[model samples]
Target: MSRQFRLPLHSPPSFAREHFAASPTNAQAIAAIDAWPRWGDGRLALIGAAGAGKTHLARDWALKANAVVVEAANPLAAPLDLAALRGRAVLVDDADRRAQGGHLDDETLFHLINMAGVDGGTLLLTGRLAPVAWDCAVPDLRSRLNALTAAIIDEPDDIVLEAVLRRAFAARAMTPAHDVYPYLLRRIPRSSLEAIAAVDLLDEAASAQGRAITRLLAGEVLAFEGDEGED
Candidate 1:
């Protein structure tokens, strides 16, 4: 059997406005978040490709609103204690994933939606696609999800990518040199998830080696056997 490698977990970063790199990609999504508590229908959905900053925005919004956030994909797994989420805005990340394994059925979601409506609480659902596109077997849940206000996150442009890289490094308390930025821009994958993974790997390498991040080190670490295929 192969050994399982466990990555180290670090403390959560202190999020700041500077860390959020606004771009045309997320302009509308950002605007909708700013206009909170006015989600008149009590339901809103954020649709985007993977690594498109959906989770980041959801976390940020949850912090700002002091709302009780729940991952709809792994919701309570038992009869939900509505009292726990009632009268408080809820943010459900990866809402589409729920339909994958029947983890979130029509009954559960309908109850949550009804609770939010009755309590005047907001419900924010995030997914890779609009509800209509999800493989939801329950007709009622599918219809309800499709009716929510939906917003899509555009892929980041070059400028936004650079800014995101810088912010991600800062979040790790790593001050990557300016020269390294251009190098990574040319070498790394455009997906935000890949970018974040690179930053994380760099952080671990730098810490293990007790040296500052440099181009040579980044290149070597990125080319290691298992990591070679990763951008």
Candidate 2:
């Protein structure tokens, strides 16, 4: 038996506004974001589960606000500076990861919160959960988190999830049989991220076997996924 060698394909996701698919699940969040400086405190917390399109929404806001984007998973590696951000927008993505207390630097986040609230900048903090649910040991930071106005994006519903799958497949120029879509929707989790991952796995499997993606291939990949999870 020979092992197949699949090259590492780089498919960078597009976070452009046109690429974002809106639905009832995220309508309010998008509306809130569009409302912008209309927010009382010029600060907001965008909350959603993994693969819930939080980054897409955040990037959309950034485009409109001309905001600088940073991951809470990796805050400023250099010295923090907020002098020039006066009355501007800043997006701190994955802001709830407490690995380093501030997405990687708690003290810096604490300061950013104060600056945005009391000073001039507009800050949008994104996380997997609401502020109340985030794990932060900083006493001062907790209070700031509580003060933020939050916009929550629920995980994708059936319609949105289907659109995500279709879009993901289209992006790769791959089309499964018409019935494959319903077959997949029934078996996979309802999430934008999950749809993308499922497509990737199926793509890899099809490429390895030199076959087009069909219902049978999807079932095989899904079965493998379940087996891996059980292990």
Candidate 3:
């Protein structure tokens, strides 16, 4: 007779405002977002690497301000109504992509920024890099974007990584020992998304083998991720 294994149900991770952990890595960025309406020039640039919670912070602020969120590439697809954005808070995510040569039209962005200024509306931008590093050709638009205050969210620290790992495990009803954090941290990439993916892979491996999560199991699981000799 074949043995049966009960598979765990998948649950989506929460991105609620209250659920966000405020650690040293992202405290400054969170503070900037919380200090909206009073921000000088009514513009802010929330910059961070992938999985550094820039989107989460932006979402939290948008929820509070009822902001209209749009991708940086939105203007390229069709005409963006600047009149509709008057007196409204606007969030433009992946702003760095606009600097990718041909992905975005600089004129559209320029007009939008100018209209926002005229309407006394707030603009929040999220990108991997600050405005200073953008490859924009329009001098006026470049100057305008650079004038906005920038809040940079740093890479994940040990505390954040541990919290991310714990949450990922908990979502799948897996109770990992405390040692699992430090053990996995030493081996996996220093990214929240990567840490979550590592947990997903490890949890699957453990369930398939009918074994408890341990340092040994983690090592075996990580080996499959090709994270060898890398941190």
lDDT of each: 0.73, 0.76, 0.77
lDDT of 1 at 109: 74
Poorest 10 consecutive residues of model 2 by lDDT?
Answer: 1-10
Q: Could you give candidate 1's per-residue lDDT for residues 108-199 as a string of tens digits?
A: 67767666655667888889988778766667776776678887788876676788778778878899766778767676765666676778
Put down candidate 2 lDDT per residue, 1-231, tens digits, no spaces: 111222332577888877778889999999989888776677889999987888888988888888877766764444446666566678888888744633346677777776674555788989998998887778888887887889999978877788888988887888888988877777677667777778888887888898889877877666734333331
List TM-scores for all candidates, in order: 0.78, 0.85, 0.85
Off by over 4 Å in 1: 1-9, 13-18, 75-78, 83-86, 99-103, 171-173, 206-212, 224-231
Clashing pairs in 1: none
Error of 3 at 223 (Å): 1.5
Best-first order by lDDT: 3, 2, 1
What is the Cα-based TM-score of model 3? 0.85
